[model samples]
Target: MPNTPPSPRRRGTARTDALLQVTLELAAEVGYAGLSIEAIARRAEVGKHTIYRRWPSKAALLMDALHRVWTTDLDHRDTGDVHHDLREQFVRSAAALSEPPIGPVYRAVIAEAQSDPALRAALDERFLHTVEQRTLDRIALGQRTGELRADMDLTFATEILCGGLYYRHLLTTRPVDETAIDNLLDMFMRAYATDPPPPDRG
Candidate 1:
């Protein structure tokens, strides 16, 4: 007989999700430097006060958007092979980041983080930290199983692998394809793989 209204919590969640979606779209369309809370309000069909209730500043809002867009689960199956696993994971990651919606959004976030300390901290805590942990965990697992070299600095090695992806993605116009991924795996794996136990303990 009468229409039902959503609870305050549901309404708030919906509004926040709408704002995040609009924020990402606008970030891709106009870049983060060009984005404004007012523009987000207009695009999200919400009022400025509504946005303020959720996020105090543009950087805060963009950090949330970065977390929403990035920080995803990996689909690479562990075949007990580190090279194949990292290759599949990285190729999938590159392909995803090279696409339209996410590609531009990722570039914008990274660019904005350069000058924004809060944003950079957010990226480290939410995005980079998680990725680094996953990569390092995978490498450690391989080392424990003799699939990778235990002598190498896992943290630095991890950075080289993932950092190369970011460097090529943002700084260079190199095509990120299977061939590129293979080459990356080749270079890193050579240095990363464990050699036979030196014939005898020294």
Candidate 2:
């Protein structure tokens, strides 16, 4: 007698999801250097072949997981006020970086990239480039819209705005907090000072 059931491919997909979730969870618990595909397979409760079938290499699998939560899109938004928009972006960006699971993952990835050529290349080309481009674009936009001083060097501005948060986070081991956001906004606005004069229609 024939039995009613889903196909083998559907079952495989279900197993893949379980493996990915378990992989991310394990990555959070243990640093990337300590991760094991075998352990992931066991924790996921799927066959080892299942994990291998989806992601042939550990780095590829890990990168895939990272991409899902940390988006690469960071287009600058012109909110009519550069300082206000930048402040808002800092708060949101800092919060994202501070997510419990994500924070540790970033630490581990950065360390690994320093030693691993493949991972370093991937990080620079795929992730870091996107972040830097977004930062540069925001500063340039501020100047173009007359919100920043025409003489301000945007390359230095982007570094000054975001680099401070990174260093402070490293020192304090605290997520970039509201005070950091406020300080960045205040410092940049004061430095840039391009308040548009009230216009008259005669």
Candidate 3:
């Protein structure tokens, strides 16, 4: 019996996903700065023109790849308690980062972005912007619910908490464990919780 070929749309999606997956694996192994179109094409078993046809530059391809992997239907439901919700979401994020390829790939992308302006812009526009807006909205919701201090600078507070995660991921080998998450929340509550007394030191 003869086999049927995939439709154009299905074939395109499959190819694109394959390329992105290879890109991420290479990024993890060698860092973004060390990856090249030739390498990606070879690894993906496609010609250079195949990649160049879709993305004009490696940065553009990576931008799309990062968004594809990291910005899909993330869990952001309100749990009625801001601290519980934030901790749950953050722990999930930490766990995702700990997964093979993702952790090193993300860190490599971020590290490369520091020295590459175009990549940095792409990272901010494609990935960071979406996450930051969601975070700000969540913080605003927490304030409205009186869980967070009304006067807290939402952006700055978000930066401190989120920045700490990135810092630990990129700079420190410390595991993003329950203890680490609790410690971060402890600092956050001390600084931003609206309760008169500080949140329990636990």
Candidate 4:
């Protein structure tokens, strides 16, 4: 008997996912300069229409793919220990960087964004904003609960903690490993996350 074809929505989504997957692989290997809709379609084994139907352009497809792989809501807590919670934040954040292709793609995107304002804006809106807002909110929550000092500046704390990875991931060749995460948290705590001292003993 003859086989039935998949539904349009299903087929479209599957093809788009495949295209994005291939795009990510190739982008990591050779950067965005080497990516093209036709190349992606060929690698994904889907027609160009499948990709165009899902994404208006390659930038849209790539941005969506980046978002697709990002793990959301990994750092929400009322654990009452800001130190441990922040440690977990570093650990969870490193999970994204630790993925082999993800790190390269992320690096490439940052480099690509330097010249492409459109891509830069897309990244800011789609990825950077989410990261910034969630981080501020969680740390702010920690502050409200008295886990972090009332005067702790969420902006500076976020920068110091988050900036550590940015330098390692994109600027330097070294990978953002567990040690880096721990050390960063250690320094951050030393500077801003430390506990208050007890009163002098008699």
Candidate 5:
């Protein structure tokens, strides 16, 4: 049987993936400060216009590349134990934020966002908002299931949970290690668990 040639759509998708992969490689090698569309084009063996047609700027290209490499779902799982689910998700995220490709690319985008209002807004809309909402959904599930205090302010709770990790990951030299994750979860459970911990027996 004769083989069929790939459709233009398939070819286009393959090209897009190849471009994104090259973007990630360059971003990792040069860091965001040194990464540029021209560099990407040169490395990918494509015209600069090809990349610009797909992505308006370096920030947008890097963001897509980061998403491609960081494929872990940002949503928390329904393990019936919200704490466990949150911890599981956070551990995964913390590792990504601490490690290569995703970590460095993400950090670069974030650093650039600090000075680019449009990039900041895109970052919030595409990444931060999705993470925050997924987290809040998990917490809301806990409340509905009677695992968490219904009266707790979920917005603030979500911020504390997500913000603390990012703060340590981005702002401080401290690693978002197991100890930090456990402490954060402990504090959150203490503040929001429906059943308070037993009185100290020590």
Candidate 6:
């Protein structure tokens, strides 16, 4: 049988993947400050217009690249234990933000966002809002299941839960170690749980 040529959609996806991969590799090497569409095009052996046709700016391209490398599940698991599920997910997210590639690339985007309003909006819209919504969803589930207090304000709860980790990761030199996470969760449970959490099973 004759081999069928890939469709235009497949070809476009392949090209987009290549562009994103090149963006990641270059960003990893020179940092985002040194990365540019021209450099990425040169590295990918494509015209600058090829990149512009897809992404409007460096931040936009880098955001897509960051998502490509950020494989961590932002959503929570329904383990019937809200505390355990949140802890597991937080630990995974903290590790990802503290490690290389994702960590460094994300920091760069954040730094750039400080001075660029458009980039700041994009970052919040594309990344921050997604995380916050997912967290709130999990908390809402806990409330419905009687794990959390039904009267609690979920938006505030979500902020408190996620803000602690991001604060430590981004603004301070303190480590987001398990001890800190446990302490944060402990406090959150005390303030938000319907009752004290039961002792862990062996």
C-alpha TM-score for every candidate: 0.75, 0.65, 0.74, 0.69, 0.78, 0.81
Clashing pairs in 3: none
**Error of model 4, residue 114, in angstroms:** 2.6
On the 0 to 100 scale, the lDDT of residue 110 in model 6 is: 83
Q: 2 or 3, which is superior by TM-score?
A: 3
What CA RMSD would you report for each candidate? 5.6, 6.6, 5.4, 6.3, 5.3, 3.9
lDDT tens digits by residue: candidate 3, 38-149? 9999999999998999888887787777667765635656877778887887887788777865666777777787888988888887777777777678878888777789
What is candidate 5's lDDT per residue for 29-86, written digit by digit as tens?
9887888899999999999998888788887787777766555545578978889999
> lDDT scores for all predictions?
0.78, 0.71, 0.78, 0.72, 0.83, 0.83
> What's the lDDT for residue 68 in model 1?
64
Candidate 6 lDDT, 1-202, residue by residue in tens: 6799999999988888888889988988898788889999998999999889878888888887776555344558888889999999888888888777678778887887788899888777666767778789999988877888989999989988988777777788999999999999999999988866534433
Residues 76-188 of candidate 4: C-alpha lDDT, one tens digit per residue: 45466666777787777687666766767886777888999988888877776666676678778766665566788788777676676787777678878888888887777
Model 3 spans with C-alpha error above 4 angstroms: 1-19, 38-56, 196-202
Question: Which parts of model 6 are misplaced by more than 4 Å?
Answer: 1-14, 45-47, 71-75, 196-202
TM-score of 6: 0.81
lDDT computed for candidate 1: 0.78
Residue 57 lDDT (model 4) = 70
- Cα-based RMSD of candidate 6: 3.9
Query: lDDT by residue for model 1 over 43-155, one digit each (tens)?
Result: 88889998898787777787777666555445446678888899878877887687866777777788888888887887776677777777888888888777787697998
Off by over 4 Å in 4: 1-22, 41-56, 72-78, 173-175, 194-202
The most accurate candidate by TM-score is: 6
Model 3 accuracy (lDDT, Cα): 0.78
Which candidate, 3 or 6, would have the higher lDDT against the true structure?
6
lDDT for residue 88 in candidate 1, whole number 0-100: 77
Worst 10 residues of 3 by lDDT: 193-202
